[model samples]
Target: MSLRSYFLSSAILMGAAGIIGASGPLQAKAHAAEVSGQPQPLPLPPALPTARDVSYGGTITLNVNATDLQRHILTMQETIPLPPDVSEKGGDFILLYPMWLPGDHSPTGTLDQLAGLKISAGGKQIPWVRDTVTVSAFHVQVPKGTHQLDVSYQLLTPVSPKEGRVVMTDAMVNVQWSAVSLYPAGYFTRQIQFKPQVVFPAGWSYGTALRSDGAQSGHTVTFKTVSFNTLVDSPIFSGKYFKKFDLTQDDKVPVTLNVMADRPEDLAATDDQIKAHRELVHQANLLFGSHHYDHYDFLLALTDKLGGIGLEHHQSSENSGPRGYFTKWDKTFAARDLLAHEFTHSWNGKYRRPADLWAANFNTPQRGSGLWVYEGQTQYWGYVLAARAGLMTAPQVEDALAEVAAVYDGRQGRMWRPLIDTTNDPVIAQRAPQSWRSWSRSEDYYSEGQLIWLDADTLIRKLSDNKKSLNDFADTFFATNNGSFVTSTYQFDDVVKALNAVQPYDWATFLHQRVQDIRDHAPLDGFSRTGARLTFTEKPSDYIESYSTLRHVTDFLFSLGFAVGKKGVISEVLWGSPAWQAGITRDQELVAVNGEVYDADDLKDAITAAKAKSAAPITLLLRDGDSFHTVSITYHGGLRYPHLEGKMDGLGAILSPLSGKISVTDHKE
Candidate 1:
């Protein structure tokens, strides 16, 4: 049967009870009743990637004064050499700041941060003009016989205490290279060579994939020759409080954890915790079967002060989290896959990149068409790798899996938009403010991709009689011959080719239907095929609890289909939910609940009151934009959270073996 038919059949088996929950008292539910639920490493790659590096033959000096980070500014002076071709190309030269950055996959270059923009050749200041149509490009006419130009500017660092600010504390800084430099506009980015040098605050140490020339003169440091690709790909994480731990002892792949935090105490990780992380490398190596880089760096920033962000690179990733990220192990483990996921990108997004995303120049806007496979597949293996390494418990992974299933199932936007189209969200949304996130689904590919891959894995197991699986597909697709810095681009057909090589099917059509076509239900056939099913629970999921605690919000997302902020404000009105039908929306504050003053407690009391009383419409007085209005919502579902249940049938036989198969008991904490 097709993926659609499979879900309809499975939905009956899974959601067989009814479309909506009954208005009864909240109670305990049994764990997946379908079937008995069973349930890295170092490498150092070379200094330079094997890409075309056109030598302009000069160093760009970037001076940063991070000592007083409260000012949120980084001053810089970039000296660029005018290539001989400048004269031949008519001197109307354009210097482009990084616009379309890789990994970010957006035109994220902060043009507004640029100040004191001045260019000089032969000690004479040259007039520069900003392009009308192109925002990032700067036009400057070169003087006669001038082989070099000096450019000076300043950058305003972002300060976001909770959001993972790019600029952390006064002592630590995450240097995004693209933010500080300007490149020539004519050649391919790989063909552009740079001798990068930076001058920072005194006494601050740094860690980056960029090979420092050991030519540190006081606070200033210079790096060896490398292509612009490597220069930008290598992010610098440096600070006052830093700790280095080698994850691998003596392996072909060298892995190291370079952690920086606001406090020294936060850098502490137990021996067991370190061992589990070390096993992460081993597990990944075992899964992929081939290594890409010679060495890897986990640039972890542990701080409550810094804005938390996770962006993947070939050799390194910016894994920023709370102060208790490592200190509070189990609680923070839900997001443990942040490091693993970004690491997987080294293979998926860096080595075997999408054809359209792997552009020639930094200014080229990346066509985010393959984010499903690029980000989606990486997300799948990230959780697997973490679990295999004992970063999370099997039950924790299951809880996390339930969140994915529930997220897709509740994603009412799927009725309007297909999964594939949202791949362009990196450019369009790219972190846009959540206006109507549930109504306008954002990046469903990651969760949906996991579901799709699970289905594919289930299909493979059934076809090959459990002799093969997605692991086989991963081993074939990711691993390359000999460790090299070379990148391989792939198309849609390449994904299907790898899958068919393991087990032949009409995968292209299946994938097209699942990803391109809009459907009412989520791609839950994977659960059914794996001898499992999705079901509802009265309690909140571990994933939900962890996130809710961190964010400090009352999420009745699965229950009433809405989330209330700390100040009795309705943050979102989920699509097709009770609140949506009642005409309740975002920014509306709840003034009263059933004639009582509205607050988190009062809201809960009202919902609980509904459960015990008649499944009556809960009356709520909302403060709309200008006027206050009363909304009556009919929501019988008291408090429902989704979890995966077992089928225990023929498919369950195959699914039970795969559950937590990647996890090793030796590393169990």
Candidate 2:
């Protein structure tokens, strides 16, 4: 409103009050008493909202005005692209303006749930079809051309844990614009046209969708040309901000760091980070092809509390937390490692992408067969590229490799299942309350995948006399499969073909047999065990539990009577087996089987045969704690030992025994 209009309204209201005051108290009272029935004063006029101008297939504007705490007005105007099939068949389109939270991955909020709706098109008062308990999906039937559309509604901003409304109070809003209706499918989109222009209360800037319109002036700017695919992936943050380093290299992409925090020194840390990250990027570019982006920006968002998150994108990655490594670790080294891992994503997971996700749609599942390559190869390079670029020392890489190797060797159950299977499985077997814990115990895809890549790379290098490495194959794969938004259909096949072409060897069979199948024991024992040098082996000083005595007795029993069930759960006491031979019955719950209990300490002992046993017959006890009796179990024979040998560091070691004394160079052919 203008200053003149404000003055005029103020003067009218004051003049009316003065006229009433001028009427004396006695005269006013007499007049009120005489006027028994009179018409009420007319209500003030309602506020009018401004209409937005939209161009292209994405001209949706929402003016959500919440000047008061009770009533809010949400005005929407959108222009969406109709599919060719829909346009041909005269398909009806339903444009929905569903309410959603900023961080919520799914739009299932109750704010948009309504009993009725009122809608109009081009100022025509048309009857809006409504559904009970749902805000109607505005059904619009239009020809296949960009047309100006407008929608406006008044809604109540429901009170929430994050303080009433996310957008109004926080001065931040995440707007989603898609071609498909957003009512039923949780706001997921296959195609979107443009990023919406955001208007915040003055003095706030966005955290995401780094403005293509330049620095926002006076709290309003139009984000003119944003593709729909990029809209869903981008989230915006508007609040207080601090500027970090703005890195500009001669031939490389510029790096901008926006540090939003309460502290000023938070921006100071970027001095070293900018330098270190630039060096790291330069090093990676030297190894891999150019990281093709105009510029790269990192948003270092520091919330009030400690935060641990790094979400990646083509041009930017969000890094938020407390002071973090910059405040805690050796600033130089830690920053280098952190930057290397995140920056590597620009090439691998971001550009190279999984073949299965070539035509990925947000609402649907796109399962790819190349987790082994995408995740595994990415893992391989994260460390390899760092080492090659001199960002990490050779020993540091080897140390990291050993840690990963040990983790893989320890968790063989992951190998039992493919990287895909475990990912698809439910956290709980039966949708029970405690199912989320299932993932905690499951095998890590990245860890196992990395081991596979290492093994594959090693074989490739050795088979071709170092003439053909995995890197060559990867470059070809990227060239062949780049620009794909869905999963790659021929990535794996093409990679295998390229490998065979260059080496002229049947490596696909090797990959399928060794890498694909769990049973194929693609041995890593030959990969040098520098354990004695790199790791410590401190044997127990006193009486450590004895496995030798129990192994012999258990081996004898396995030969005689007991049977092992799937997953190593000892199932039955055989009819004439040693367990049965020792007077064990059908319902006997063995507490201490051969002096080993069903606990971690005892379980490891059972595997190692560390629990001591009687020289002759063994007295096994069954118990529901204190209420059970002893079942006499006599040992007869032995447990089968699955043993295999492989050469490493010019020396041989038994794989099953996992002896730490194996040579480190036995595998180098």
Candidate 3:
């Protein structure tokens, strides 16, 4: 029978019971039948249900009242109809209440402390197996048909400190027995044991990252996966939603969005976000054959406290963040860009499950040495898509690239390590914290790896007509590898092979040379420079200070053998000495030296070099008010340069004496 037929059949068995005490008086009803004479009629006790019997091809039902205070409960009295071929074999049925809810990252692992787990079958309490991890089980004769397993337990709500200010908008709450129960059964590599029907706070709408399978009076979200094993790991979410965007393609592949928001602004932003995301997904679909699922949904929630987080599954993507995060320019741009990043995972994580990801044991450590490609390559697409979608302009894209470049260039870590190590060693891949020196062995896979991808993208564009770009390779990668599952997982070598299969150049040699060994940086210089340029102009102000003190120092140190200004810029030409010899400079503008900027640090590197090696020459690029000129001077060691000495002390102690001076003020105590 079809799922609808099953649901209809089950709904008939459930009958149309008026939702007791939905918005009315709460009272106790007893279930005691009859009593002796002269006594009042006994009240009927509340109904409770429990699971019993596991025999194949059996049907069972139990009458029970689910607990809900404000709203009526739409109890689905349905059985998990296993495939006909699989026999009723015994195995551990695991159940787990995710420590972290969808889009929430707070430490909620303690929620397993539930109170009074009781199961009743036919007005009689039944003994079931219990586990230490807050799970229960029932051993019974295997039955086929439909089985009504009723489980009732009390959930203690956590009182948050930021309650009034915090809000969870567009939230999709899904509760499932099989999900919570992490049980393994037969040959079925169960992803999640029980997927609870959602129980959200009444009046709050649902926005989930899971598809909604149409059901009677409610929605049923069926998970679609190439492999049953892949499907099992991806969880399902269900709840009421604020806004729903149905992107179902002519009834074949379905797409829907469940949107929630804390404020009206959030809804407005989400609307815009959804519109942009639709186009992006459309673009991604061009590469992959067809979305694996019939319908796709985004469980999007805008929360005041919940920061940005996206956990992608097969059919749905869960995204949550602050309400204003998607409205402000910088924050919104970043948030939307991140959403795209997660969206790309539909291909990388969902379609092409990493070899390490095949049997992803969330309980154990996940080792993905190729995260540089997995996460890093995917990260590269976030900004690319954002720009291509018009959310970010080409200039903004260049600026973002500049930021990444500057970060990579300034980092002390990259100097000592190669990016490929992250792909080679699982320890470095997982980012295990080592000693300060050892910790510097790995750099950000996303930043540098993205640069690599960007560089490759430039090369691809230059090598091939813009007609054949990374998009083509992306399409080819997905088409050739989509849904291959276990036997044909894509690896680093597979990616290179794919690129080389259609490329005009030696891709592996290029990857090894540029990615493995550092070369002239600006691999995307042609694209970036053409895309954006910064115009710097000096602005004069009346509040500028004079360099009289520096001149005075120069004059005083004349006997020490340092010319005040010789060359146009600061230049320390002495080798092995303070200035060139000592590594000091002549006329280099002392913008900032030794962790102190020009304002706080009186002496610059050029001046320090001059003082340290009095007999050396140095260059300085000075910008005092409207004056911008290069100056160089010669130095001969002797009298200690007070500015240099004090500056050195500050650098050593991380405290500049000039800036560290304390003020005397009136104090009470």
Candidate 4:
């Protein structure tokens, strides 16, 4: 019977049956009770008070004891003064831990690590409740005649990498104020004052942007009063082995490089290393033509124990390097550009912020629509400045760019997701590992955005006959309000305006096409405009070699479409590649290749042999979970890695240092 006729007949029979059954009262009640229960959503509780642009009326005193190295606990005591109005009529008061952290570009506050939270007023403990909607907020009823409240908490710093970032180690400690302090609600963070102090382990020197109030008494040090915003931005990096090097240029604003290491010998920096860092400062000034902070500090930690960081701030940056950063400078070229990347943020991200990214308080959500300019342009200048400062050779930077180009070009996710949308990955993915990273792109804006800026730079040079470049844009956009660290927020229109002022063009349409539109291919016009071509070769570039050595991975990305780490574990598998076509995945063990024990060199040999013998498939034994299987990959492509070939005059010009004299002042703090 036809589906329609069958349903119609069934409905008629059911209706007839219902009529016959409804003759009895019990049957009629049973037929009426056929409806399923549906529940409505309950109303959410009221939101916490919104921050107002007004003063908090009193300075908050925050004391942190960070000497617990064994347990990695930061004991915090905060004294908050109550406003006169709040003291007279006690009502609901709210305190917030930082949620939307600056530079993280997401709500990544370590609220889970907060423990033993207690609040008291007038020497008596007061009850508090956490806000249901915003867990970061604490709601409390203030008692009448209460002038102040004493808050105490302990931050359980992660001891292992699996838990979270290890901020405290036996020899060093990184104290981020946002993790250990609470601010009152209903006032702008900039309008709330804070008097901060920290007690560290004995004989451990510290580096921070916060100016010291006086001489340290034993292990305790107090800093001058600053707004809560600045307090959070200025973090402390203290260690037993510490050294400070001055990279100040022309004796103008002071720029210091503070180094902390795992051992005392790791602080041994050669004269040339120091000169390169000084040149980094000089090149940055030559590019932006201004300085934002009165004094800037580069808090560099050279250790393998502390959690790695490259976070930027207005006056200082938190950075990490290998234990052999200065001791083995030749092998550390892959990480040389970290300082440049963070330093550029002083102008791009801190001084000139995205309009939607600026928040009035720590609890406010920040939109990442402008991170393409905030982080992307910074990435562009990072490599450029690294080359210009002699930290990395021009060829090395070119090789680095070649790798970036290859990765984005091979990214299949671009067919569906645009570069602009990846800006949301910080919140969407929180940087968690993905099963198909190449297919599901994660934060392509950093490198892909770098390519976009390169496109703009080369286009500007071509239009202006090499008379103007992105340097002019930087000078016009970021150099404003020199010596002032006050944030200047900008929107999309401002970026386009600045670029047009540098070189007349339809920047809005250009940016829209590259950023907003999803395309199958990455933007490679920048390399072509510079007379360079991205090509694959059997030999890996020096940069790629260093990368593999540093990361402890073997790359067959272009051939087998996967990278193998130690013990023959597949770290990544490119989507739609031969390995992927064979149903291979990441985290799987390549137990054997072509009936032989799995080895990086052996696999390369197998791929090469397969290239010569087209009919012979590369057999692989893989282990997934508890299951083991064998598969044959019919890929004939030999080992291939990306490299740049042809003239790179335009790129060379972009990386060459501007003619200037660098004067350095050596000092120890």
Candidate 5:
């Protein structure tokens, strides 16, 4: 790859070509061969693709039957109305299975699940072949009299939760078109139109943002003809037990809440939560100053039997959570900002998308290098809208900020890996399990993303002398002439320009430094800007407890630099934590502490006990590699946890955003 090596190879190739030209012309060539036997430059892979046409050749009708949940199978049949122009090229036709699904951020379409796939016309089966190179494509030669084609296939659903929880069940089902449909390959997704119909299990109710015609007898429903893009974006949920709630107010900006649960009691939400969701809608409109959907549907699944999903879309979101999602609202923590977060996506992700991510066809994989803005910015707004809507208290927000700082403050990965590098992990890693996630740093961009935007929001307030905030950036960046659903793409410079327009600064360098560089410390400057500083206290913050309880896991993660999951088993040992130093490793069981039975609380007490007496180390009986050994954790930093404390007279500025109350008190900088 050196310059001298490159020139040497180029001269040698030129001399060989000249000698071959002087001798004779080669008359024969083989597949993938160069005539003169010299190596050739490889062809590049496909880049970003755009839609060639916006009009469809004709409407295709697709019908699916997914009522057989016990068998975990879905049957699909489609009628293609092929026009003359479609077969203008050598009478060869190509069909494409949906790939690179929007919002899933990868080519997660269930192609391997396809079974018994066949295409036919004129009462005879047409011979078809799967393209060797592009596995998602099928090629068929149309006969002289063939004017249309019929396709049939059976889609196998996942029987296990780990494979994917998004499929169907006897109680309820999630219907994603990408799993059961295919379309002509020549046209763009938005140019291919489809009229879809579904027959669900009898006596089940379903909810989707798709424009529906009406429900027919016994669980059959039909949807209006829509572009392939729109149909794929619209997913449906059907449940034997279902309920609907209206979170709308004054008939303006209608936001509907559709809940489908496994049990009857789970459908009931308290009046207070109902009111807060309506306020969530209000704060979203107030913050972004725009609406992009005709009407929004917040489809929620509260289940223990089904897999969990939180995919965002243009008109609705697929949000599923643990059992007792509503009945145990007091103890369950998912409801706080689940709806608020997805609603923000309506404007930030679905309406205004990153330019590279806005591929005209689902065939082209969306480059996730910009998800730092797409998901990260939305995550920032999710927490803000939650607090503003009173779903989370001001204290909770402070605690959350503290945890964010403590985490990134010691994130071992940031020592080598930059925050921006995490954007493409969902695709690169296929969202797979990781052994050393802290060191590998799968997706710190979501949390660190919040920090960067937080700093910007605080910077805007300081630069404008409290004249404006991120609200200006939000309104200007997402605004449109109407609230109708439409998409506009933006680049990194567009975001920088918008931030600069709100309050002038070298935002380009500011962002690049925070995101594009590897730093030893966390981005804690957002705290000082908000008039607060991050400090650790002996007691755990509300954010820490809430996060741990929700995940059903505990974090000695920041404290001892280790985390334990269910049954007191060590899930991970941080690279340089007290646990790791003491020789505890992942998959090892914390059997006992100080000759007492081990539990999360017992470990905490032992740590506290070690601090009480400097000579006494926390003794742990760990089950490591099929053998039990006693280990000692010798550290004096007794019970350390993160919390945000107000800086000199800066409490007002910090509390204003959290509580929405203007501070009456004033003080020094």
Candidate 6:
């Protein structure tokens, strides 16, 4: 019989035997009546107070002591005055620590480092509770007639980089106010007033945008009163060794370059070096056609001890350089653009911000959908300004751009992910290391965004017969409210409008197609329009040599599809490349190359030798954890490093000096 007939007969027999019957529902219901343990989540507590635009009655006084270098601890005492209604009724009070920090674009507040928190009012201690949700908030019951509360806390700085950013060391300290203090939650940060005082280590010099109140008592200095927003925007860098240079010229606004170093020798900047920095300011002014801050400060730290940073603010920026920034300026060409990058942020990111990124308080989340313009354009201008100011040669800048182009051209992730989606990487990944970076695509908006702006600039130049470029857009978009530090926010439409004003084109469609669409190839039309092309050579460019020296890595991505760091450890592997196809992965140590102990040069020689014959394959012995494996990669492409060729007049015009007469100097050692 067929299988269906046999099943039907069995069902009939079972029904007759009472095995299947109409009482099935009752039996199932009886089984379902048994207990099954399950739990439901409890309702969350009330939300924190929303920030308002009203005034916060009185000034908040904050005092910080940062002398404990041995323990890497910074102690802070803050006094927050309550509003009239809160003081009279004596109900619930809330204090919020900054979470969504600017520049970070993520909730990176170091709440884990905050310890020894104490709150007192009217000479009596008050019990405080951390909110179940939004743990950055602290809730307390305020007693009637209590006008203010005294809060004390300690910021336990990381002793090593593995824990967090090392903000303090025996030689220097970086004091970010947001990391050390808390503020009332009900008012806008700009509506609250703050008076800050810091006690630095004795004999240490510091630089900050905060104007001194001229009230210094030995080691402590008091700063003039400022809004809470400004207090958080201004940070301090203090060190045992320091140097200051005046970059102000032909303008009422004062721009100073304050540098601190790990040693006194590292602070030695030559006259030419200082001149280049001054030219940076000049070129920036010429490009934007205006200045925002009344005065600007560049707080630079030349140290290997303190954690590296390149954060931007309205009137100042925090930057870190190699210990050999000035002492070995020729070799440190790779780091020369840091100051220019951060300085450009003063006009692009600080004065002109994305509408979605602006928030009333620091705890509110910031949307980074517009970072492509905020950071990407700034990055493009940074390289241009650096070359214009003689910080780097035109050739070096072209080489760097070639490297950027090659990287995006080889990015396998572009096939699946669009450039616009990578803007969310800051929050989605929090900069965590990924096993397949080439496939996952981490923060491509910065470099790829640079390419997009370059494409726009070249297109504008072409359309306007070299009469207009992104320079016009900068002058038109960011030059508003001259000398005013008030932030002006913009939306996607605003960007398109500004570009249209510069040179009329189908900018909306152009941007949408490039940013929102997934494609197999990178945006390379900019190079072609600029009379240059990305090409590969058997040898690396000077920029690549310097980059490799600084990073201590071998660049075999184009040939071997992998980059090996020091001690024969693999740092990166391109997805779907020959090495990847051979099962080679990152963090694996290359034990041998063709039966010889692994060496960078030896591997390169092996690759070169394998190119001569069709039957030969590059043999590699790799170690992953305790296991060992042998793999053969059939890549015959000899050593290939990206370089730019062809006429560079279009790029030269874009990178030409816009300010004063500046001579281009060769950056080669």
Q: How well does each candidate superpose onto the true structure, as a TM-score?
A: 0.86, 0.55, 0.54, 0.93, 0.88, 0.93
lDDT of 6 by residue, 1-669 (tens): 432343356556755544235367855653455334344233345678889999998999999999999999999999988989999988778899999988988998999999999999988998887876889988777888999999999999999999989999988999999999899888899999999999999999999999999999999999999998899999999999988899986765789999999899999899999999999998998888787788899999999899988899999999998888898888888888888999999999999999988999999999899999999999999999999999998889999999999999899999999998998998999888888999999999888999999999999999999899899999889889777778999999999999999999999999998889997888889999989999999899999988887778999999889999989999999999898999898999999999899999998888888777574888999999999999988877889999999989999998899854222221111
Q: What is the lDDT of candidate 1?
A: 0.76
Steric overlap count per candidate: 26, 32, 122, 0, 0, 0
Alpha carbon lDDT of each predicted model: 0.76, 0.43, 0.43, 0.90, 0.78, 0.89
lDDT of 2 by residue, 1-669 (tens): 332344356567765664556567855764675596644343242221121222223334433322332232233333334444445554234444433321122233344523234434455533333222234344444334423334444444334424333232332232223211232212234334553555554565555544545635555656645554465445444444455466545453566655565454554564454565555555555444345345666555554332234545556665554443344323223223434555565666666665554443333334445555655566666666555545454444554554455434533343355454533322222112221121232324455666666666666666777676666665555434332333224566676787776566776776665455654233353243312221212121011111212111122222334433223333344344455556544333446656666342343344334223634445555653357666654442333222212323211111111112212221210
Which window of ten consecutive residues has the lowest lDDT sum in model 5? 660-669
Rank candidates, lDDT, best first: 4, 6, 5, 1, 2, 3
Which of candidates 1 and 2 is the stronger one according to TM-score?
1
lDDT tens digits, residues 195-306, model 3?
3334345454444443334421323233222222333334433334466666443324556756666555565545565565665555456434434444566666666433
Q: Between the candidate structures 1 and 4, which one is better when assessed by lDDT?
A: 4
TM-score-wise, the better of 2 and 3 is 2
lDDT of 4 by residue, 242-310 (tens): 999999889578899999999999999999999999999999987887777889999999998999999
Candidate 4: list runs displaced more than 4 Å. 1-38, 661-669
Residue 558 of model 3, lDDT score: 19
Cα error, residue 307 of model 1, in Å, equals 2.1
**Candidates 3 and 6 compared by lDDT, better number:** 6
**Candidate achieving higher TM-score, 2 or 4:** 4
